[model samples]
Target chain A: MATMMNSTVFGTVVPHKNPTILRPLPCSLEELFCGKVKNYTHEKKIYDSSGKTFTVHKSTLQIYLKPGWKAGTKITFPKEGDVIPNIEPADLEIVIEEEPHPLFMRENNNLILRKNISLLQALVGFSFSVPYLDGSEFAVDVESLTFPLTPKVVQGKGYLSQRDGSAGNLVIFFNILWPKVLTEEQKSILKKGPLSECEYLGLL
Target chain B: MATMMNSTVFGTVVPHKNPTILRPLPCSLEELFCGKVKNYTHEKKIYDSSGKTFTVHKSTLQIYLKPGWKAGTKITFPKEGDVIPNIEPADLEIVIEEEPHPLFMRENNNLILRKNISLLQALVGFSFSVPYLDGSEFAVDVESLTFPLTPKVVQGKGYLSQRDGSAGNLVIFFNILWPKVLTEEQKSILKKGPLSECEYLGLL
Candidate 1:
């Protein structure tokens, strides 16, 4: 024998939630290289206590950005947008957008730097230094002859991954500056040298 | 005043049509450079005269591919797929896919060819020749010292536009081969000459 139980249930129908329009949050390379927390304050409509009336409410969304966050990174804040009569409140989406850097260009996780150097620097050794995105300077002593537009790779110097906490390589490209003309004496010296495949001097 | 008219209308309810799944058509660079016609034979179910029974029908789709057509190019055939009860047939979509070439690579409207040359050939003059995608050969009599990985652009030599009858450029890049060791005499000869910016000889 079982006893009879009565359960009364009442529920409100929920209309489809409104879609969120992407809002761009532009950040400089410096801010992307260093982690930061940003806060946004805006006004949105919310339901009053009577549930039929609407009132404006001020809300704030806090975003914690990690290092090396890239453009198109989306963060969704639930129920933070305006509320309509019978529909659920829309979500607020904040996407990260990068501004072009003065020194470095990012590809995936690698950082590329392009520079023009004199022919002397390409033949002999040269000291290379540049201020990094984090406002820190780095230097490399290049002992070998550099080729034009050839990348000199430095290990573990680029963007640090926010997910894996790992770093990528930094690539440096040098463009050679060729002299317009040579003197008579210079031409004679060049005409006298390296008869065979020895013209690529240093390696030979 | 216009004459009053009585028009009887007979209409049928239209159901939602089926969606199409894209079918990829692989093409060689040669075939893409030279226009070709491709035919595909397939079997599909269609309604019989009673409009209630299914019948298997064999059909063919002819594709006319033009020159310079790139990957992801789509061609749609209306109502060429299987038919179900009470709905229009799905459309057939054919997408172009590029096959890797043994000699040349395509970039937009341009063709790129990479080659490796000896150091002697780079210092002196060299003759360059390669078979193009259209089975035609091209030659260049390089009179200057060819720098490593420098590109020689030949205008109006690549893909011909099917729409406007225009053509693109052919870019040739050369990589230099360096000698592993040099004789003592060769090293001395290099050390004595070119103290100034005369090393980039022909230009300087």
Candidate 2:
């Protein structure tokens, strides 16, 4: 067994008794350089991930990266008007864990250090019945089905209706965490459950 | 005069330009009971305000509403379990105003609305930010800011933060949108012309 104690990605050890909300891991350490690493310095706001309980802001932080830059050691800042796509917020699961992820060696003679994780882990999605422009409400699912990149960012444009003549490529960040997996049959029950199965039903 | 448009609430004539991000008016009948609503009820999906995008899974939705309970109303529900107070994502903006809100309302049945509106109006506040033990995330925000109600909802126990040891009320819902009146010293710089003042450069 993996010894599923309350452990987090950042190597923080949370008490087994109390589970913590995990924060979405950023795309990469180099990516967190909100501005040019050269012009703008970096600062880390350390919190006692286990002891202190803080709420994460729901707003998406738009990162502006410099031009002509690729992911490598030579990190650069985003230039003005440069749009850094954010990870999906709905796909993110913020939590405080008991222990950080263990470090492992790669085939290349490099080491992978442990840190706080913020990104989509397995999957996340939601279902709701919202009113449409045609004057009737319908039940539909909004699944953060795929990612633009592995170790996904917290904000990214996900799937939308192609038939609707609205903005085709709408960008949004997922901030919700994934739910516990159920048997395939249980999931089917949820999908085909009675109209009154859900408790916190809200019309959008 | 501003372009004439079919107002959503109250069915009055109004100006058209940009959609308001927040408001106090209730969602219009056209928006509340659309064809999409039925599809989501039967299919268990969520339709965005644009009536275009939707998700498919229902497991995540079940976990998101774990602590909530259904009211006597068929579709309405409330939070019941852990007080995870945060803004709801579906209700991104709280209210939509078809007419501009005047600085002051006249007494009696006659109401004086604001004019020369640049966009539609709505008010919104962060509802809750809860983390599932399983790893999903959900946020709720309304379109309109209805005085103390929205703020109170934001400050409630189960909406945003899971819980902190500190007992005293925390300042989570600070008003960032209060129009900042120009200070005497700051106004003096603008009067001196944009590039004329050296101090303004540092401030920017």
Candidate 3:
């Protein structure tokens, strides 16, 4: 009987499985970067050993999301979807959805934070404290004048990929806040010529 | 002999043609809507009756651009590209490129002109003279409160489509000029309640 298991005529055949049903599991960028475990309770189907009788049952699914798990990543469960009496059960899949973070945006494994400063501060140098996921803050200084769209990037400070254990970059996007109106007194001070060429170009 | 022209052996075989070379012809949106004729003086390779030698010659290509021509629209000249010995000439194509206008942007057949107004003007409504390409002006009144990205569209004021002989539309994009700093006295005036609901939402 054990040797006959290798023969196709004696082997037991499995029925065709139904399609997959994907459910979105939304997570913030911080939660995905640090890793999290979430649970969902839903109605499931249970079948008898003979596959002739079925009943609805409540099931709790616990999902562990690793660090750097991007949106659209799927966690699948075999035959956990709708179960019919005659048809095969469908596969249940949970897809990761990245919700918009208040301060940070995730691109691949990298993180981007947009900061706006006055045009005067942009031409001159400015420094500000940047917050980390662990509630810690560090000063990121701009020694040189910064321009729009030319981000200041620090390597290996972004999310860590669990797939290959690779760390990504942290990007700081600076936006120049131009003055809506300038007084004649302020204009005279700028014309006295103490600022760099960047200031002149920005004002013009 | 006339019947033999249908046979495969008697049929004239055309040599393999080369790829197309596209040249950009940049034009202003106004020029495209009104129509213009422009000429280009370029060097052309002149091949004699035999497919053995070629000589360089100066040729002038005069192109008549039809009204309402959009960017990326192409005009083709068959076998007008490089002429090499024993090699078929490539097709020369002229692609239309829309230059940035001082006042307007084109989307489909519609023209969009962006205007900035004070926040108070946005809530209270305002009117201004909109300029036309022919140096004419008309008053456009905004009776209700306005928001960003919701433009005022006027039908049949846009670029004309030569393909279908249909007229386009004109769109006015309004941008709210929010005050950078509100005076204490001005804040009290608003708090006394005279502005519309749009102003409150904008401030918030």
Q: Residue B190 lDDT in model 1?
A: 51
Q: Please state the CAPRI-style docking class of candidate 1.
A: incorrect
Query: Tens-digit lDDT track for model 2 on A1-204?
Result: 112245455786543332222242223222221223222222222223242433332333333443212232222222211111221111222221112213221111111222221112112223444332223554545443323122322121211222442221212232322222233343333333221122221222
Q: Could you say which candidate leads in lDDT?
A: 1
Candidate 3 structure quality by residue, lDDT tens digits, B162-185: 778889998988765543443444
Worst 10 residues of 1 chain B by lDDT: B1-10
Worst window of 10 by summed lDDT in candidate 2 chain A:
A80-89
Task: Tell me, by TM-score, which candidate is best.
Answer: 1
Instruction: Name model 1 segments beyond 4 Å from true.
Output: A1-12, A41-43, A46-60, A193-204, B1-204
Error at A74, model 2, angstroms? 3.8
How close is every model to the real structure, measured as TM-score? 0.51, 0.12, 0.50
- Candidate 3 lDDT, tens digit per residue, A64-139? 9888889999999888875665456678899999999889998888989888765444444568999986468888
Each prediction's total of clashing residue pairs, residues at least 3 apart in sequence or on different chains, is 0, 120, 0
- Show where candidate 3 strays beyond 4 Å: A1-13, A47-54, A86-88, A196-204, B1-204
Stretches of candidate 2 off by over 4 Å are A1-34, A39-68, A73-204, B1-204
